[model samples]
Target: MVTSIILMNVERSKINEVAQQLADTEGVSEVFSVSGTYDLVAICRVPTNDDLSELVTRGLLTIDAILKTETMLAFKAFSRHDLETMFTIGLDGI
Candidate 1:
């Protein structure tokens, strides 16, 4: 899976509406209103790079209300699967 974190500069009043729209998008998993240079942030997941690109090109960039965006592709994550499978408990005499 490919995941991206998008930071956006959105109009203050439109922040909520825009965030909801992003959250509802098929590839977007979550959205948050943040206090920073950017008004909103979104976490999105897609099957491939192409889908991620499509979402940025078609889903996000196409909107005028979205003044700007910065996208970061996730390289790592913490989860039960990663923790249990990657770490091994010592089996030798202790």
Candidate 2:
């Protein structure tokens, strides 16, 4: 999967509305209203780079309340759960 983390600066009045809209979008997995430089953060996962591009350009950027956005493409994913699972793979047979 192609995962993208999108940081968005939205019009203050429309933050909640925009977040809900983003959450309902097809490729967007989650939307968070955060406290920082950006008002919202959206996690998007798609099948290919072309799908990512279409989601960002056509799906997200089209929102009028979104003042600005920065999209980051994930190269790799690491999680404590995954690591633990990997290390314990053969333990169940013991």
Candidate 3:
């Protein structure tokens, strides 16, 4: 899976509304309201890395309400959930 963290700059009042809309999109996994240089942080899962780029360029940039965004691609993730799924038969370590 090609995952990207999309930092969105949105109007504070419209953060939730924008997040809700992005959450319904096929590639978007999660959207959270945050306080920072960006207003919302959204997680997107695409079939490929190229698709992730297209999504940010074509889709995200096309939205007028969105001011700007900084996308951070995760090289690897160390999570309990991922570890469990990777070891279906159960591993020696928890």
- Expressed as tens digits, the lDDT of each residue in 1-94 for candidate 2 is 9999999999999999999999889999889999989999998989999999999889986799999999999998884234445567686533
The lDDT of model 3 is 0.82
Off by over 4 Å in 2: 80-94
List the candidates ranked by TM-score, beginning with the highest. 2, 1, 3
For candidate 3, lDDT tens digit of each residue in 42-74? 989899988997888887765667888999998
Indicate the TM-score of model 2.
0.83
Task: Mark the regions of model 1 whose C-alpha exceeds 4 Å error after superposition.
Answer: 79-94
Which residue pairs of candidate 1 clash?
none
For candidate 2, list the clashing residue pairs, or say none: none
TM-score of each: 0.79, 0.83, 0.78
Q: Best candidate, lDDT-wise?
A: 2
Angstrom error of the Cα, residue 48, model 3: value is 0.5
Off by over 4 Å in 3: 82-94
Can you write out model 1's per-residue Cα lDDT over 1-94, one digit (the tens) per residue? 9989999998777888898788888999889999869998899989999999999989896566888899999998874234344455762322
Candidate that scores best on TM-score? 2
